[model samples]
Target chain A: MISDSPLLKLALTFGALSLVSVGGAPAMMPEIHRLSVEVNPWLSNAGFARDFALSQTAPGPNFMMISLVGWRVAGFAGLMAATLAAIIPSSIIALIVGRLYMRFSSQAWFPVVKDALPPIVLGLIVASGVVTAQAAVSDTLGFAIVIMSTTIVALTRQNPLVAIATGAIIGLAAGRLGYL
Target chain B: MEQSADSSKTASGRPLGKLELFTGFAEMGLFGFGGVATIARHIIVDKRRWMSEHDYAAVLGLGQILPGGNIINMTVMLGDRFHGPLGSIIALSGLMIMPIVILLGLTLVYDAYAANPDVRAATIGAGAAAAGLVIGMGLKMGRALRLHPIHLGFAVTTFVAMGVLRLPFIATIIVLAPLCIAATWWMRKR
Candidate 1:
């Protein structure tokens, strides 16, 4: 059998993710979750979910999931390569543009870049919401939770953590009762 | 920004040490799960207190508008805040390491049990929670936009057009953006 390098795979997945991860890491959720669970079978859906949760609960950006995906594929080496792959491309661009941005603070193009971005980002973020919803909400109880959460989110100004904790508790209780 | 120079100064005016960056990312990496934005918000405003809340909102708005990732923009901005170019690099590394490590572990378990039923159920549950989180975020963004009634009308219209009508991405951007901009310009003029 030919030796498959998980490290290389991890690098490639995130490298592509870097380029196509428009709007942010969550925007790529549908694709990345599909790739990780369905296409490559590198990580189980549950495992991916847990890793994602961990990534979310932690600090920093959403792109941290790439590291977990990479690490799952090939141990420590995979972890470094994936994290590097996920961050380096954007870092380089930001670094270069940051320098230029500082220099061109007074230029017209800066505002143009600014003006052109909001709608696109809005659309992408909306798409991300759809994609994440598709992967996450499954059963009746789960579906209700999603709708309730969405409604509460829209209607109330309560902190999101309270809502999340509430849903988690409900879900956990439902699981204990075999109602899920 | 108005803080005295001595308040921010350490032993020297040097950038953050490698250790600081590493530990910072690790803490965030380990605990920054759930909605990544919340973690991101904490880093920008609470932990580092780099930018004021208003500035954070402005930058976040701009980041959301641009292509690439919103969190990445925050990372860059925060990096710029703490240590300029070098600081940004450290910050990004600090944020990314933990997730990758976790993902790698998932890959191994996935390879072993791709068809497991319990795993499928867990994924489904998690996905629901994610939806809830997204809804929460959308509400937050909507509130922040503070559009006038007319602009809010546009936002709702646009949301329905894109969300329910399933318009193409470019189509939505092309159609709604100019209208919003024109409306905003007109509103400001009056």
Candidate 2:
């Protein structure tokens, strides 16, 4: 029988994540890197990096990294626990924060929060992309993928989903043909 | 902060309220597939007309820089803009609750089959779709910003630098954003 301990760990990490991560998931990159790679023996940095890339390219959210971590640590059960842990605490916080923000929204200081938010978020997104690219975009094949994806994104008005679908189809076909 | 948008009547000629904002956020949470930011823009600018595309871009730019979820940041920006602090809270709560519920549901299915080909295929498809959505949002941001040729040049150059030259994302943004902003301001003045 599989244990539930990893899942609990995920929940605790995620809860702590929501509270401390002022700069977003990328801001927590150092800590996550430390935990997943240094403190814990669950996975190598490269393995975690691969999962991070997959999650970034995958649908849903970056937090899905937790699921990948869970999978590495404890298989499918770990995945569920990690995924749940990532989702729940932030949700509850959102509920309470949302309620409280409503109560004091009109106060003068609130706008300050609004004003401070944008630059930080923008910086983090760029940082997140950089971190992903550092790990994922290696050599010619990876570079080609990044270039093609960016060009298609820049030039086309087609739904972005279609672009990703196209890439996956190619990846799958390549994999099937033993090219990957 | 403009008078028109702050006090403007929506296309439906209905004044939006706290409930509408909450419901809107809930809907976004539920159906916001593929690059949450893209879906976010749709809900805020296109569907709800809660804010203009430009405003959305500003807030999105800000949210992306902060920690946590970009969509959550957008929720806060919108909530604060429209209804003050309480609205931000309502919006954030609505956005988060849906996904937690969905993930919990996923846990049940996950337990049933660890190596389900269908689930694997779906996630792959979803991943590809997500990449596409982000590309789409980049396109949308390009249009919404109505950047000049120079600004466009800066964006394209950075994209190539980041995507091709494999330049660091933060470093490029740091170096280029000021140039872009300066050029934009110069162009606007002319």
Candidate 3:
């Protein structure tokens, strides 16, 4: 009775995150990872990793991972809760500040905040990469795929989906070969 | 961007309304693969002319450093610009319609076949690649920014706090954000 239901957890988690997701929702991925996989233990490493992959692979903003996580945890209700919670709070703030932003973009403080945030966001993004990698890699072949995929996508202008689809084929081959 | 003195207006120089916002954003939601930034710019500035290049840049620039997803913020801001509070709702609904539907469709398929061994293996593989994709994306951004020394210091600190030490995001960001902003202000003054 003390523990909250998964649906409640989904709402609470995303609602809180939506406000602080300053660097963007993807920047919140590490926190999401920690809560769902480590602290509260709602999803397994593989489950979270799969959801991250699907969310990224799907044709939408990077923020859609909330929907995938919700669906995995509690079906339709979870999906609605997580998506609405993740989106609404921040949208409200944006609505309030947006008018000011357009009018005052050239104001003294605007550029400083803009310049300052990127490095921090970049760091969070790197942390997210690390967290997702931990969830995804269970063996040498899997590890190798991550490294190679990172190299190819980072060094070139190639689309990221190339790396994803290639990894699937490699994994299928490796899995059949019993390497994984 | 060399875009000169153009006033903010749609392509036909007519005022934009909720209908335009909905359809425009719906198009972005449907085809904005990998991300929506590029597609959003193309649609708003080029195809729809809802906003000139200069105006789009100003709003989207502000959108980037603010909270939430960049496109979501852009839509909210742009919706308000074109209409009002209600425009925000319409534009957001436009953006989510196709994405939510497609995401749910994918979810159903995933649930139906997830128990299969082949599917499991592929999912694992795809997940690994996704992890790499994320890392690669971070690296790409790092390259683009050419990190100032101050910026690099903060980036390294943030990375260690989250990735190495596994500190909670809320407290760490609260502590670091002001420090980083102050450092930037100092640098700008110099």
Candidate 4:
């Protein structure tokens, strides 16, 4: 069962993921979902969505969600495995990039990669939104919350915490009213 | 770039003590709720004057292009600038330790209350709402960049490939990254 050991799996999955996590954690959400939800039955889609929502309510780095995935799979040790695996490789690259960034930025190829990365990352993000929504939404109310929250956050300069908190309050009220 | 980091040192800047760096980053990490960067900007630029505003902006820009979490990269660069690799490690640990511990604590509480219906309802609602935040974040990033037709095409393609098609993300990115970069190169040349 060494092949199936959750700790090893967490280490491998996140270790590789840290490197490709361009544009930070949100950009990798699509891939994160694919692996954590589908590739491994570590958590259901709704559970994944809930975990993400939960992370937002807490304070930490954007990558904190990965810890939840690890925790679900293998508890405290799993969490450590995932978090360390996620941070170490990427941080090393970051250290190297920090050293070379100025040198690289002036080069011609730099602009191309710079120009290319944002859009793809954006696409991944929007895709993550859709995937999360599909899992979390179960009714018209849930659908409306996503639509409204998206519009409010995108159009206005409101803090995201406001939207999330408001959503939680609405959900509580809706639950009381038997609409949830 | 090194020159700027070197030259712009405030009286309090340059070789910022290991203790100061650790405590500073620890505070940043602990309070980093929605975004760590804003707090970082506050502490680094306004509060401590560790880096000038312009310098902070430059580091942030570099942080974005780097391969890790933008804030994480920012910490590394700033730490390295101040105290080299040792500083980098200290800053990172200081920034992460409390947050990681707190996240673990939250997970413990959530696990304890897993069967609670009220918690379930609210979490689901919150999840639904947070989905919008993700999409909106993408839109905000899009607004920041000048969108070419090529960028749009690739964005849509990547979205469909991953979100709709549910292709393996690692493989999808592998195939797409080079192709997208190359396509970008071709477009630029044309």
DockQ of each: 0.27, 0.16, 0.62, 0.67
lDDT of 1 by residue, A1-180 (tens): 223667777777677667545456755555566668776878775566556644553444666667667766776787688877876776566555554543554664445445433443444455556555655655678777777767766677665545555566666667666776
Docking class of 4: medium
Off by over 4 Å in 1: A1-4, A37-39, A43-51, A155-161, B1-68, B74-86, B96-124, B146-190
Off by over 4 Å in 4: B1-14
lDDT of 2 by residue, B62-180 (tens): 55434456566667766766676676778767775665456545554544653555444333333333333344444545565565456456556655654446554345545765565
By summed lDDT, which 10 consecutive residues of candidate 3 chain A come out lowest?
A97-106
Worst 10 residues of 4 chain B by lDDT: B1-10
lDDT against the true structure, each candidate: 0.60, 0.55, 0.84, 0.83
Runs of candidate 3 exceeding 4 Å displacement: A1-5, B1-12
Highest DockQ model number: 4
Candidate 3 CAPRI classification by DockQ? medium
Candidate 4 CA-lDDT value: 0.83
Among all windows of 10 consecutive residues in model 2 chain A, the one with the lowest summed lDDT is A116-125
User: Residue B129's C-alpha lDDT in candidate 2?
Assistant: 38
Q: Fnat for model 1?
A: 0.30
Angstrom error of the Cα, residue A20, model 3: value is: 0.9
TM-score of chain B of 2: 0.59
For model 1 the local lDDT of residue A27 reads 50
For this target, which candidate reaches the highest lDDT against the unseen true structure? 3
